[model samples]
Target chain A: MKNIIQNKSKDLQNEIDNYLKCITDSSLLFFEGAREAYRGDYDDAENRYRDISELERRADEHLKAIQYKLYAYNIAPDSRADIFELLDGLDDIVDRAKKNIFQICVEKPVIPDCMKDDFIAITAASVDAVDILIQGVRSFFEDVNSLEGYIKNVYLYEKKADALEEKIKRSIFQSTVVEELARKFQLRYYVEKIAMLSDLAENLAKKMLMYKIKRII
Target chain B: MILKLFYLSSGLFMGWSLGANDAANIFGTAVGTKMVRFTTAAIISGVFILLGALLSGAGTTGTLGALGAIKALPGAFIVSLTAALTIMSMTKAGLPVSTSQAIVGSILGWNFFAGATTDYTVLYRIAGAWLFTPILAALFSVGLYFLFKAILENIKIHLFSLDWIIKLSLILAGAFGAYSLGMNNIANVVGVFMSVSPFVDIQVGDYFVLSSLQQLLFFGGASIAIGVITYSKNVMMTIGSGIYRLSPVTALIVVLSSSLVLFLFASENLQAGLIALGLPAIPLVPVSQSQGVVGAISGIGIAKGGGNINTRLLGKIVVGWLLTPLCAGILSYISLFIMQNVFLQKVFI
Candidate 1:
């Protein structure tokens, strides 16, 4: 019984372990780059963007390895396709985070005084959404019954991030903080970038739910 | 050794044709889909079939023996040659056929030529088995599929492990299927030689003995193995890339169920059990593996909700079922006539 348990959980464990590493790694690297940019350390932020690129590449490689191994090892064909698709969707989150950090570094978009806390808040909420999604993914493998709670949290933070994105956009357009429409558009683009991060997390959570249903059926 | 071999070569030829065609039934899906190489499949099947024929290809009487025995070596050779030719023709025509049916028909034709009595009771029983093989195969496959599906769904096994498990199951089932095919069908290949066997009991050790029938089966098995190694690739390639997209698991289930029916039909213990229960014993018949496989496949198709069932394929198979015995019988009769009238040989003792 113990041996069977170990074998059954082994693949799920690998999925969770690898997925969490990419999620955590991309999230941390992106945030660190954002912090350095906020502190006017463009060189450091640029370096971090390079790191995020490196991380995303590594994550993709890791995901491909897991995909091949899982397929080769013994997952049922029906389940195999779903897992590959799920991981593919999850990998999107890291890709988006890497792109967002790269956008900030290239544009060197100036952070205005009034929207500083809001930008930070937006980043935190996106991170939280992803964090919840990661947990949901973990709980799904650990105790599938308990996955709903983490999934709910993922949705909750996604909605929260969406609202924060709306507030930041409104403040940028309505307030005379920078005076140029182009500059305001730049701010909106960066704000939407952060919101899209949570969007990706929410998309991943939905895919996870899909895979769960597939498992059940 | 050489003269004896020449006499029984026809039987070995029939065995070769059987292995060439039936190799598709056991290893088609795996080889077709490129999961396993044709060479690998052939080698594995060959080894298992040889083992199966040597070990359990015993006591193949009751039905074929009752039909009529070719008591003369020349008559047995003629019958085997006729059967082998029929099978070769069918395979050449791209039809998967039952070598068992061919052998039976040939034996009956020889019975006619030799002026021996063909027992209707034995013919009726063999006919009945051929009739029910597909039905029984379908039923067994449906039952086993549901049982396996239930267990898998309940366990909700991780996907990777599930794949691993299915592949392993397929290998085991395929091996067993090949073994069972050899065990049950070896009779068709060499059963005609039983009465004509000149060899005495082969004493191996103080406790072991190889009978004449077993010795004939071993040679027949080697020819079958040779057929697998040399041929089987063309059929595999044709079927693999064809319209049939059956999963490995489905293939495994079908093979398992078909082999089970074949094994059950061949089992002396099971026949004895039936007799003990005061029921008619299952005839030790050389049942059609092709029919059994078709039946199992149909059963799975039905169980999987019936929409995917290929009506055209089923119809073709049903037609072939009717055609197989008739073609074999007529060919055997004509061949026997030529051998008797033209060659002027005594076909009976």
Candidate 2:
């Protein structure tokens, strides 16, 4: 019976890992789509953002599953609350990112000379952090040893996201025309969404670390 | 036995008012700030007040017993009932006043009516404490405001950087306020009963009891706690609406600050640490929770801009605080005079 319970929780963890992988892949596709849109490939960017939104929906379902289990078991009320809150925060990030892409498609923004590198860095960092998050939760559940290094990497990724958001904000301020400024603002908002995605990933990794500390998982 | 029952019932009523009104002081700021819903705030304050009373109510009972010559069971009952009624009536009028002042005033009235001389030194200390409460509170509020702001700004560090820190601070601060409220204010709810328990009696001469003072205090604390949980909601609502709005963080700060001051005053003996600092010995004067928090709020309002401080609300509070003792004293005097002249005389006749 104990083994059955353990296996069920492990299965849930695996589901989370799978969803996270989809998130990373969708993120990459969205970034590429964004690049294409910047280069006037509007249809492809729209498709990429649509795919990312669908991935976000899947992630949302996994989060709901985790929440439902936490509520069912009544294990640690505080921990459960934190997890649910973090999930909502994660969903918010994806929602914002998708919304920004749709707006960008509507505008057909003239890409700035400086913002291209910042936007690329934002996408790369966001994707990498999600990758790190999936690995952290997976290895932590599978074996405690796998999480030690990955958790630190998750922090590094979050910092990278923060840096990217800052760069994007600075680029937005430097844009001259109102239209360009507005487009820069949209890009900055998208970058911030991606940055918060890293924060959510970092939070999950921390939760996994705590569960291991208490030997509760 | 019937007379004792009357006082016991009154004590419970007082407790309920204390729970409803004073508990708000502990939690109002938090509720006002929208940190915790009103229902959650009420529950947290109510449960913890009871817990604190059950755990450390003895010291407060002792303070009440030592405050005056409340020896005879009958006299004790009268005093308790008088104080309780005074508190209830005052509370009903939308006044966020202290039951502490009401009790002290009623006790003095009881002494005058009985024509008994207790100790002058005790009375003097109490009166002095009462006089100094507002001044001390004002000073503390102004000083603590700047002090905390300085720490928050100058430290250049956030204490809540980690998630666990946020969770821990909330729980710790809430529990501390509840505990301190229980410790200091339990006596206000049940103190008169301590002197008039079956085991003790007022001899009109000394602070002697017929039985164990501790037992009576415990009963008073327990009964008052019950009252607060059951019927304090109306008073709580009155406070929430009447006083400045409270957010959860502000409520937490208010409760913590008031509870800390109350605990210091109620301690059995001054701590060596506090004494070494050359701070004056804190007298066991039951400070009003309303006064403590209002003072804090006024400090906050001043810091923001004194114009933001609602003069109308401030006026109401000031009127209530001034009138509580006077009204309680006069009402008790009239009630006791009637009891002694009309009712008691007829019964004896």
Candidate 3:
């Protein structure tokens, strides 16, 4: 029985590791795609978008498998629902990353040189927030006590993303270089889309904090 | 032959009730939290309970015998019947009840009816053990709680591995709890009938022997096992979710601590070992598993900073401790009178 339980746990852990890897890979892909788009490398950004889309599909498959195994193996019956919610929240991070990159690929907005650095900064901040959130989720499974520190980092990166997002929007509208209102709105839309990743991460961090409290023995 | 079986049925009925109610104390949290399936818990608890009764049930039975030896079969039957009735009535009224306390009270009533002198020393020992059972369990749980907490904090085990550990621990603890329950409370089921038991000792060649007392306990244990198989699921559910929502880890600790308390009071080998070590021997007496569980939970509450300790529930348990025996004693005396006079049966010799 012990061996059976250990094997089940190992199997579930492997699946979780795979799923988390997909999310982490998507975040990296998102950062690269956003940087490429701002650099006017439309073909490279489009390729990154395709890679992230595949990862999103794989993550969905992993999520379904994980949900099945959790019920089948009857692991942590009391916390199963919370675990499902946490996994769904994580999957959403990758999903949001995919959608944002897809939008950037299709819209192909011409980046003004003055706002390009800020766009890259916002993407880096959002990706960093997501990276820390992934670590927090891993810590939730491995060492819940260490999870609080990771969650704090996620929040910090999210705050940076928020500040950078506001700065980029203010600059796009205030600068005399981009005169068209429609072009400014397009830039603002891209900024919010990228910043939304950090928003999702922040919300997930709050939920993870509550889940951690419930997990305390 | 049939008449003897008829009289023994009351004791079997008592055993059934014990299994129905007390098995919950052992496996309730595990089943309630869905950590273990009901079928698995029942099978494990049933087998261990019978094994414990067959192997080690004599110690606590000796203590009960010393309390009041019901010399007549009819008297023993009446005592068991009245005790079982008391438990049923009290449980129906939503009052706390213990088979150990009820049986002792019924035996005292038998003594009164038979004009026999009650052994106050033995009575005091039994009563003292009853009072100490929960406190001992409480102390054990508190110590175990800290130990487990420290180990978990230091180890930082993964959630999946921890869940596996808790599930396995709950099963092991439930088995131990079932064994201890059988060892201690089998006395309450058949102890009174030991003096009048009809079974003869059997020897198979030179290797195996089964005494009449062992035969009696075997039957009593079977009845308890049957009760577990048939009626314990709902009780387990109620105990698991209704009475203080215990996490799987806390449930393991509670079962372990309570089982240790029951084993201390029931294991003759442990008692002998203590005496051999020049320490005072632990008394072999039937103690309530319900009391042990309650005490363990209270210990946990205290360990968690004393909030959520229900003093009103504690007060009600105390009232139950006092009231169960008194009610059983009165019922036993009246029932014994009716059996002797109205049924024209000899209740005493």
**For this target, which candidate reaches the highest DockQ against the unseen true structure?**
3
Query: After best superposition, candidate 1 residue B23: deviation in angstroms?
Result: 3.0
**Candidate maximizing TM-score:** 3
Where does model 2 exceed 4 Å of error? A1-31, A34-53, A59-217, B1-3, B28-68, B117-121, B134-167, B200-211, B233-244, B271-279, B303-308, B345-349
Distance (Å) between predicted and true CA of B17, model 1?
A: 2.5
TM-score of candidate 1 to 2 decimals: 0.81
Q: Give the lDDT ranking, best first.
A: 3, 1, 2
Instruction: Write one digit per residue (lDDT tens) for candidate 3, span B213-316.
Output: 99999999999999999999999999889965898888888999999999999999999999999999989999999888888988888888889677777787
lDDT of 1 by residue, A1-217 (tens): 1221234537555655876687787887788788778767899988988887887787787787777765554344445677677667778888888888888888888888788888888898998898888778766655565677888999999999999999999999998887898999999999898899899889878888877765541
Interface RMSD of each: 7.1, 14.8, 1.9
Off by over 4 Å in 3: A1-6
lDDT of 2 by residue, B211-288 (tens): 444545455555555555665555555555654555333444555566667766666555445677887666665767
- Native A-B contacts reproduced, model 2: 0.00
Better of 2 and 3 by lDDT: 3
Candidate 1: tens digits of C-alpha lDDT, residues B283-306: 778888887887888888888788
Decide which is better by DockQ, 1 or 2. 1
**Residue range A1-217, candidate 2, lDDT tens digits:** 1221222344444555665566566656766777787678899888888888788778778777777755553323334455455445556556655766776687776666556677777767876776776666555434444567998898898889888788677757765632555565666666676576677777766766675454321
Native contacts, share recovered per candidate? 0.16, 0.00, 0.55
CAPRI verdict on model 3?
medium
* Candidate 2: CAPRI quality band: incorrect
